[model samples]
Target: MPTLASTNAVEIDGLGKRFGATVALENVSLAIPPGELFGFIGPDGAGKTTLFRILVTLILPDQGRATVLGRDVTTDVWDLRRRVGYMPGRFSLYPDLSVEENLRFFASVFGASVEEHYDLIAPIYEQLAPFKDRPAGALSGGMKQKLALCCALVHRPEILFLDEPTTGVDAVSRREFWELLDRLKASGLTIVVSTPYMDEANRCGRVALIQRGRILAIDTPTRIAESFGRPLFAVRAGKRYPLLLAVREYANAGTVFPFGDALHYTDRRDGLMPDAIASGLRDYLRGRGFADVEVKLTAPTIEDSFMARMGEPERAA
Candidate 1:
């Protein structure tokens, strides 16, 4: 595939787009290498969908340009469509059509046959075959997601764009879906997926945390977590809520945010000490009828790094 600089599968530089008065995407630039599993993670209204649309040629940018597989998105949309696969967040498969029918329809639309691409979608289609005769709308959330993915893969696209592929899926289904993605990545398919779940950040090779149409940070999940520049401690009292309030208001509070069952606290950047506050809060919480109370330093999570980076600029520390 030809890239703008000859080293990327898709390239976007100084890209800008808008929807009436609202800015959909602003100066967004990213390069995805060939056969890479890139992720574009963010919350609702984060311009993820907008950027995907622009890259896939569903919409054009007002400023800057984007090229996919070496073809300009604006001028070579027809060829780009043949080279890329997209699975929108919504289920766009034909509701009235059967599972096999939906798959065949999309395959024929691209002038390809399911038999020709069975190897490309075998991992996913195997699970979908049991319900091949069922109406598209009758499949469970997990089944529907798989069917959608199979439809997207039937064309053997060089670059796959999945927008929140696991949203609204059951826990088991979500895990299974990711497992399928891992196998697909192993097959040398370049993937770019977006999701709002912070825990899923680790699954991606690298992620771009976005909010309010701006990026907070872009780095490997481990690197992002390690970028936390403070000594973090997890504190839990028998009474958790009050304990959280107390720790958050403490004079030493640098960043106080809730973890799973415990609260994570860090000393202020200025002068507050973590050990002193931990010792003090340990006693303060126990005095309030807390049992088996625990306080100790802990590792930062993806959500922690996202919140911290969101509070700062796009540049990493």
Candidate 2:
């Protein structure tokens, strides 16, 4: 394992990969500290999965190298596998096997019995105990995810790689999963989780933003959000298209994106106050034949931060 002060728990330097003409990851480099819950945040095609695969030794990198717990991912494949627990984006548990059987199977594969590592998986397993006899294929989405997580942890790994562990799970399940992760991290587990959920980025000790097979920014969530240096406004109306047009046509509009409830707007206006901007937006929407128009100054959120950082040139903040 990497020494405490000398090496990171996970390190990737000058990493690059390609699939024919498509570049999957490019010059990606990062150093994750011991016991840190690091997140790779991006969209579906943003190369999050590719990076995870390389780090866990599932795929080989073409240009650079990486080390996990001081073991090279490429050269020390077998050793790395024993040290890391990987829960891929999809559930890959045996469909015919029951939950308990699945857990026992994974434990035995590592030369350890279920009783030997029960403490490591007990928290997640408790939620799955009721369905222990149910076929893995018949379990609910959340239960299946929990089972997969438990199976990965059965051998007591030094690092856990969760690739969108909450992707298809219910809202309650997602909350519970994160809570369980917190408990495990409190016990000194190093976790690397990749997700398309920007909201989950803040829960991580640090986050790296990837897009189009390249890294955009990596920092604490607060630092990433604080980097946005513009006044923001949320503009809304009965119809979004015309409201968007009006906001875009507004002279002071700097950036505009469709946020969940409204269009988040930013501007380069120096002296234009929030009230003045709000007035201009309402008047323009009214002129465009939209009613019940509302506009308000709002703070930047993680989603807003992602849009501001990665959206197209015209919409960039």
Alpha carbon lDDT of each predicted model: 0.84, 0.86
Q: What is the C-alpha RMSD of each candidate to the true structure, in Å?
A: 2.8, 2.7
Tens-digit per-residue lDDT, 1-317, candidate 1? 44354578888888888889998888877777887777787888989898888888999999988888878999888988999999999999999999999999999999999999899898889888888999999999999999999999998898899989988887899889888888899998888899988888888888887776666677888988888877788887766777777777665567778789888877765455767767876776666666777889889988888788677754443
- Write candidate 2's Cα lDDT for 13-127 as tens digits: 9999999999899999989989999999998988888888998999999999888998888888998899999999988999999989999999999998989988888988998
**Candidate 1 root-mean-square deviation in Å:** 2.8
Candidate 1 lowest-lDDT run of ten: 1-10
Best by TM-score: 1
TM of each candidate vs. truth: 0.92, 0.91
Cα deviation in Å at residue 180, candidate 1? 0.9
Question: What pairs collide in candidate 2?
Answer: none
Model 2 spans > 4 angstroms off: 1-6, 239-242, 268-275, 289-292, 312-317
How many clashes (backbone N, Cα, C below 3 Å) per candidate?
Answer: 2, 0
Candidate 1's TM-score: 0.92
